[model samples]
Target chain A: NAGVTQTPKFRILKIGQSMTLQCAQDMNHNYMYWYRQDPGMGLKLIYYSVGAGITDKGEVPNGYNVSRSTTEDFPLRLELAAPSQTSVYFCASSGPGSNQPQHFGDGTRLSIL
Target chain B: TQLLEQSPQFLSIQEGENLTVYCNSSSVFSSLQWYRQEPGEGPVLLVTVVTGGEVKKLKRLTFQFGDARKDSSLHITAAQPGDTGLYLCAGGPGYSTLTFGKGTMLLVSP
Candidate 1:
């Protein structure tokens, strides 16, 4: 049902370059999140938005930016891509209910050289 | 830092065998969720155990939550080839963030 969709399944970037990771959901959920997973590590939150026009930094928000302009779209931006930023990025969305399950996107695999 | 520790970072077994993966933490959670992720795919929710000491079964898979809500386990009976994937457990302590485990990489041979 197009629960959560992320763009650019794979990407290679040069150091200091900037790019945006796009995420969209059709579930009409009010909560959206961005997370990154490193090799052999658990996912770390990058940013999150409770509703449109409201966003907050997460555990690992360094070198990342996010915007929630609409209920369905939340994009994560990397201002200066670094080698440490190379990882798999996931987008998730949930409803208003407490502890509701999050629907995850296919994830974006990005590498910086 | 709230962390979930998963036991035996990796596992390999043959079809028709049974295995169990564990997830443990020192903090009490309001609920826990299990997800299975295949190569190059996002994780799909397997089950959610909310109450302490709760157990649920889905086909060959069984999920159990600890009495203290600080631990959980996944048991697969008569495993099949399709069970090969990464299993992750996430704890939601009624917070906005969902903390996840390192994950168990299980390989079920045919």
Candidate 2:
């Protein structure tokens, strides 16, 4: 059914480089989010968008930026990637609101050296 | 701050055994969700518990929401190899976004 799809399943970047992690959902969900999961740690929300043209910052949004120009896509941009940013990034989507469960993408494992 | 914490970070048991996983929080949430993630894949929804004192059951899996809505628990009866995975709990923040717990990895061997 092509739930949530993320591109570039794995990547290696040099310190200070920049890249964008792509996320797209066809479920017509109203909420989309970007999160990072480090080893032994839970997922941390980086950014989220409620709908097209609306976005907000989450717990760890310092080095990341997100844009929701379309209802089906939300991409997280990492500016000046650092070694500390090495982690697996996940994208998720949820329906109408408060009580819905989220569906996640497989993830993108990024390693910055 | 991270809002959720899960106990028993890792668990290994024989098939047909029983196990319980916990998720606790200091903040109140309108809803709580459980997700199971296998290696190399994203977390998949297992259940959603809303309202204090709410309990839901799916086959051998039983989920309970704390009476105060600040904690939850998952109990699997007679666990099987298919139940092995990383179990995560997520709470809906204010209106959107979810705060996830550090997950419990369970290994149910045959």
Candidate 3:
């Protein structure tokens, strides 16, 4: 169904490099989120957007930025890659509701050396 | 900050075994969700419990929400190899955000 699609399923970056992770959803959900999952840890929110042109920082927003220029696309940017930033990135989207379940993409496995 | 604690961080059992994983929190939540994540994949929604003391069943899996809305449990009856995955619990505090537990890794061997 292509609910949420993430590009670059795997990527490797050198220290101090920069890159943008692409995420797009076809469900027309208003809520989009970016999360990083580390080994043996739970998913940590990096940023979120309630709708196009409206973005907010989540629990862990340092070293990252996000833009929601359109309802379907929300991209996360890393200005400078750090070793600590190496983790699997997940993009999720959910319809408007208090209890709507989030649909997630397969995820992008990122590594910084 | 609200935190969800999942017990039995790792579990290994043979086929036809029954096991239960737990998610506990001190803070009350408006809703709780269960997700299953396999290797190289993102978390997939398994179920969501909103009301207190609510119970939902999906085939061999049963989910329960505590009456106080601060805890939840997932019980699997006669688990199979295909059921092996990481089980995560997330609590919603009446917003779009969710506080997630570390998750329990389950491995079922046939």
Q: Which portions of model 1 miss their true places by more than 4 Å? A: none
TM (chain A) per model = 0.97, 0.97, 0.97
True lDDT of residue A65, candidate 1: 94
Docking quality (DockQ) for each candidate: 0.61, 0.73, 0.72
Comparing to the true complex, what docking class would candidate 3 get? medium
Instruction: List model 2 lDDT by residue over A7-90, tens digit each.
Output: 889999999999999999999998998999998898988888899999999888999999999999999999999999999999
Name the fnat for model 3.
0.63
In what order do the candidates fall by TM-score, top score first? Answer: 3, 1, 2
Tens-digit lDDT track of model 1 for A1-113: 67899999999999999999999999999999998998789788899999999999988998999999999999999998899999999999987533688899999999999
Residue A57 shift from truth in candidate 1, angstroms: 1.5
* Candidate 1, residue A8: how far the Cα is off, in Å: 0.9
- Cα lDDT tens digits, model 1, B11-97, are 999999999999999999888999999999888899989999999999999999999999999999999999999999998778667
Off by over 4 Å in 3: none
True contacts kept of 1: 0.44
Per model, how many backbone clashes are there?
Answer: 0, 0, 0
Residue pairs of candidate 1 with colliding backbone atoms: none
Candidate 3's residue-wise lDDT over A1-113, tens digit each?
A: 88999998999999999999999999999999999999889899899999999999989999999999999999999988999999999999997643789999999999999
Q: What is the lDDT of residue A14 in candidate 2?
A: 100
